[model samples]
Target: MAYSDIQKTEFNRVTENLIEITWTYVNLLEEFPRLDEQDSMSWKQMFVAWANEFEELYGHTNWIESEKTYPEAVEEFAKEKILQWAGIRKYICVGKHIEGITLNPYEWLLEKGQDVKLFESEAEAKIYLKTNGYTDEDMEFLKFEEVWH
Candidate 1:
């Protein structure tokens, strides 16, 4: 599926050192209905930063917040945490098809001294990796594929 088609999802690393974000709410209240208080709290802690992106994307503060329950607040907190984990200071606009990365967006990454590459195709991204200092050895470990797919 495409990023636009995906309602909600997550990206997590298998290693303990790397951040792990699991998309547990793709179908919202359908496939996984009724997030228990405990499960919701865990999700909040794990994916808080990601949730924040939605708020920014929508350009509004959360109108429906949970004050009576800690889980709700925790879920919101997870949004911020998710971004922190992704090393993103701000969101950036990338090439239309390139999305789903948890890290800072292209412009933000560039501003922060990261080598940001926005390409129209994966082939372009690969070429950039090769010409811009990446070697075959380095390429082996990097995943250029779009994660949202």
Candidate 2:
């Protein structure tokens, strides 16, 4: 069901505050001066999308994690999941997807030697897709533009 207008407003406010605080903590750890605003915004968007996917996959049941260290282990597990998902999804691509039963072009691009690759530029991603047999019409997906840009 769709959220009501009030719910949307509240959610937007809450998400904004939560993300800003999280970014502040991240910056404290990174200790880099003057990080790019665009980069933080991109990360915030990607994290939100990943969180939604995570909830869909594992939020229905209150399944307790099996770790001896209690909450710290759970925290570690969550952090690892986010890092892995970011590595996979935080890149420009034509028609990107994160998971699959079998490895395929849409799932992750591979170089000529079959090692996985992430596109550094939109042009590079487009060229890679075409070289791998994606046609002009197929290139219309532009996954990053819709989701991350």
Compared with the true structure, all predictions reach lDDT values of 0.42, 0.49
TM-score of model 1 (CA atoms): 0.23
Model 2, poorest ten-residue lDDT window?
28-37
Can you give the TM-score per candidate against the true fold? 0.23, 0.30
Identify the runs in model 2 with alpha carbons over 4 angstroms from their true place: 1-38, 63-74, 81-149
Error of 2 at 146 (Å): 35
Candidate 1 lDDT over residue span 1-149, tens digit each: 78899776445222211122343243233422333333556665655545445345433334356343333443434434543343433332223222534363432113245645445466666676688787877555455533210
TM-score of model 2 (CA atoms): 0.30
Which pairs clash in the backbone of model 2?
none
Task: Name the 10 consecutive residues with the lowest summed lDDT in model 1.
Answer: 12-21
Off by over 4 Å in 1: 1-116, 147-149
lDDT of 1: 0.42
lDDT (10s digit) by residue, model 2, range 56-133? 544443446433433343344344444444442335544454553234445545567975556667788778778879
